[model samples]
Target: MYSRLSLSWITSSWAIGLLLVFPVIAIIYQGLQPAGDLFQHLMDTVMWDYIRNTVLLILGVGVLSFAMAIPAAWFMAMCDIPGRKYLQWALMLPLAMPAYIVAGIYTELLDFAGPVQSVLRDLLGWQTARDYWFPNIRSLGGAIVIIASVLFPYLYLLARTSFLEQSVTLMQSAQLLGKTPLQAFWRISLPLARPAIAVGLSLIAMETLADFATVNFFAVNTLTRAVFDTWQGYGSLHAAAKISTLMLVVVVLLLALERFSRRKQKVFQKNMGQESARLLQMKPWQQWLAALFCWSLVVLGFLFPFSMLIYFAAQYFTDSWTTEFIEFSLNTFFIAGVVAVLACLIAILVGLFRRLHVQRGSDIPARLSSMGYAVPGTVLAIGILIPFGWLDHSLNDLIEHFGGKGPGLLFSGTMLALIAGYLVRFTAIAVGAVESSINKIPPSLDMVSRTLGHSPVKMVRKVHIPLISKGCFTAILLVFIESMKELPAALILRPFNFETLATYVYQFVSDEMIEQGALAAIVIILVGLVPLIILSRSIEQH
Candidate 1:
């Protein structure tokens, strides 16, 4: 009985379950009203276009992500490549470059008056737009490229790990049987890694669906954008909820697909001492080709935008990057830092409890917490607003009744609410990171600790925590970067006049202030690059 109710595990799981489940309940209850009418609206007005655009983006992102991620993962995991360590981090750097920020910078860069067009015009000496046919930024294909550039790392990181953990013997035996390396990879390695790949694909699909900032920035009509138009423009939370419900259904299908794919299929083989084999040497041309591929991804995804930002910053280095920009940068860092630490701690508690409590219902909290990830940032912000508004109203009323000011603390339109939203949305990422890390520790270690009369806390501290220290740090870093790049939640929930780097850039870009926006946008990317590069290199070493 004592073992069954280990305080650390049970308490953590229960709290986590509540946190995860509450918003889902709110979303469903809110969405259920006016269902029939909402469905018709969803069916009628441009909804199909939104759905089609969203679906196409997902499909395109999926194909493109896998195409880039699989080969990169394979190269890092299996082949001898130049700057393998550098490549690992370089690939992950785009995570710091938010899709929307990328959208803003790319829009400026590709605009008729932007540098690309200017350079083209200079080379050809043709002034007018008709003289040279540069593609427009505000189009579907452009949206796909912008989003996929930043999002492929999601697939790359997961698939690389999957590739690295494949038993060398299987690949070697296949090659020994006269199969080429490519044939062996497809037959032996690819199938084995399918589960991880599926998980990655599901995440990418769901993220593509949940995206609001990128689609809106690029002027593509997606479901998330539809939700915003319905709620804000139409002043209809009911309509927004309906759209959210449909989106939830889509997310559920993705979750089901991932679960179905993973069923009875363990990606990680259990045997110890199963290390990855040596990388094969490539011909001179092959080496150059591989290097070119990696470089192209890094350039399109990270370097180009960064270079543009640097140019802007240099022009403003002694000019407009003032005390105000510095303050905004500090505030952004502070909030991101707090959210990262808080979310990680909460995730560990939630994850540990879920691990220890093996009841049939234990999976509920994990599912619920992860639902935040499925929520578009705009919808999640709106969901948070509903409860926050009620809380604020109730508190204000209570204060007036007592002839005094009530504590306007909970949702005071302050940074606090923004941080809470971040915790709710990103806690899943933290939980996932911590859970996967903890899962890697041998169960025998815990058993041994228990047998030695160590308490549960002691066991975790001495055995588990030590083992997963690097993972804990990684989780913290990942959350920090995520929060840094997060847009809609911060924009909607932040107090009047409050700003993060993302919001600052968005504001300028929305008003067509391209030059200053590019400057601030670059700052956000550089901030993301520092940690992303470090984490990527760390993973490669592992």
Candidate 2:
């Protein structure tokens, strides 16, 4: 009887185990190859500086993303600044803008032949770029700003949820004890909210580490880019896998830190809680200042890049918006739909199974499933490719021995492999969203179901799942958004003659054809905005 419920549990557990083990298996396969010479080559080159720069960039972006998100969360969640509700949702709008699109816009803005420099040349009589003081956008610092801008929403969403869920009584007690608002926030709020903040920061760090498109675009040699460089740049999969292994080690360390921090904090929200934390009135000047601060982040993150894309897209429409763009759009939608549905189903199972077996070291499966989020998409693709390629070879041999010949299955050449890759890569995101929502359901609902002699499946179907349908939908939406923006895995794994909007954009961008790329990029961003808005609305409800 227990095994019946645990069947789903076992399936999810094995799925999680497979997800975690595949990357390790791929790295070991690469390492077992006779490429000890590449390791020496890596040691002899600027690998140390690459490591340092990557670490520094991660720290820089993590700190900046937090610096931007926390205050905004505090103000929007706790303060009574004008348009607070609007600002709350608006803060999340930047998630719609992909990092590479942000990089492209900044690159154009800072280029000598671009608009800003051109304006300076025309208006201020500047001759050469040497005479100007504008910052270079194609550097490490630029990558930090670009990634941080789009990434802060992760922290913002998590931190704001923590802030919203704080018991009002504790805050009132802090106020009664003669603590000022800021003091109350610092002492009572931030510490209690540390779990959520830790999770958010860990996510940001993981993203900063796993990111490939933006880092590659900016020419920053992070481990992700190093994976590509070693594989494509040097034609050595062994060297690439070594770098990927190193990245996994760093990510595991960070995940451990997040779990430790989360476990240390006591969750104090009582069932019959106090009033919602009261909002304080700000002066007119303060309101405007707050609005300006929030607006500046949105502009830097979303508006500026979006506007640039609109401009370039207009040009592309005039020049080359054709049947190719339409076909790519359809392909993008089809792939995203497949990834979202599959990921959401898997995540729901994982979330439900974990909830049912709450005391059974749920962390094991949870961490393994989430580990895919930490793995770079490109690395995960390679991992999937290795195992699938081997499976195909083995299966084909067996088929030929028994019957006639079997069609070259698995990764030989098929969309199924691509979908599998997407599922493995993005199942973490769906699990996170569904798990978070499931965590909010009271334990009594399931207990009530059991008390009435309901089956475990019925208990979940009737009691637990209905409570979190919105969250499931949001998970699907979020996965859809991510699938649309996914570049590396889709680029590497797509069958011959296949094209996605992302791939179309990449082709144009690779050749410096920014105008056409901008058209496709804009479409991707617009598709992403629907989920971003949905996520924002969900946060507000909390």
Candidate 3:
């Protein structure tokens, strides 16, 4: 028998769920309504270009992500390659880097005036751009490469873990049938890992779809950029909402695929397949080649970009160390801090309600709270903007009815909209962490707490809070880091003159002067590394 649920607790939980989900609902509602000529204008004009580019981007990135990840993943798990120890986790470093930052780094290096081309020009005695043909690093192809370079870790980590967990006997049986190691991997290991790979691919697609700065930087207009331009460029909420709804369709499809893939995930015994004998012995040259491939991804994706950032920052520390940097750093920390604490508290309240209350649909709030995770940030910003914009208008009008100076655009114009957007998008991360920790506590502890004459609140305070404290801290940190790095929502919803490291870096990047903002960019990258470090340590511990 579960503890009796209090009306207040239940009502509060349900209300939180509704509030978190309201933005997405508002987007749908606004999108369904008829907009003026601008909507159709978009439909007839650049809409197909956006669609074609977005589709091509997805296909190119998906195919490339698989190619980049699958072999590295296989090598990590199954081959006796040199540097396997460092390379396995080092490959994940790129995942922490924002795609735009990496794009900017490569753009600088590969551009005609940058060192690579300049050196080539000097060595070959070519005078100018017309003299020799070099691939442009600011095209759709460049965007695909930049995105896949960072995003492939999603696939790599999942595929490698899936490969590790397969039954050893399956591989042995394939080998006994005279299958080469490569043939065995293709026929057996890869097939069984499809569910995990599917889930990973879907995540890659979502991240790729949500990407804005890289595509925008490279002048490749995709749907995400379309949503930003449709709203900010033309100031049409309904038109933006319509575009957002289109993106939501893609999001929904990806999510449904992920859910189905999760259900189809296979279970197996003999999960510990990392034995030395089971590992394939590659020749010395092959080992070097395999290790070099993994290392190249690390260098291109993380090390090279990061080292270049360091060089730029060192060269331009005086320029980057400015009053603006301090202001935006404080702004970022303040906003991320507030969002983290609030998200942590909300996750605790909602998670505990589901765990202890035992009411019908108690888990609904938890489900609803995380739906925003699937929502792209640009769409979510619009979702938040619509309802809150209405609220702001209504409130200001009501105040002005009595001849009072309206707290003008209070909700929508202030940090409220920004905070709301962050909460909706990132609270799910907190909720998942907290819920996982809550699950580890045995049911008997709950019964004991209840039987000691403690009420629900008291029971949680004395028991659940302490046990889940680490998870709670992790939730806060994760939300804080995500809030810090979040670009799209922050870009759309930030108050006038407010900037975070991401937006600040983007400004300099947009102008082809990333060196000026390199210090701030380094700060973002370093902060982003915290969670990755924690994860790496945790993986090593296990």
Report the number of the highest-lDDT candidate: 3
Top TM-score hit: 3
lDDT of 2 by residue, 438-515 (tens): 889987877777779888878877877788898889889888888888888787678889998887887766556777
Q: Which lDDT value does model 1 have at 243?
A: 78
Can you rank all candidates by lDDT, best first? 3, 2, 1
Q: For each of the candidates, give the backbone clash count.
A: 0, 0, 0
How does each model score on lDDT?
0.77, 0.79, 0.91
Better of 1 and 3 by lDDT: 3
lDDT, model 1: 0.77
Q: Could you give candidate 1's per-residue lDDT for residues 295-385 as a string of tens digits?
A: 7898888888778677777776655477777878888899989988987787767666556556667667666676686777777777776
Cα lDDT over the full model 2:
0.79
- Tens digit of per-residue lDDT, candidate 3, span 130-180: 999999999999999999999999999899888888888888888889999
**What's the TM for model 1?**
0.84
RMSD from true fold, candidate 2: 4.2
Native-referenced Cα lDDT, model 3? 0.91
Question: Clashing residue pairs, candidate 2?
Answer: none
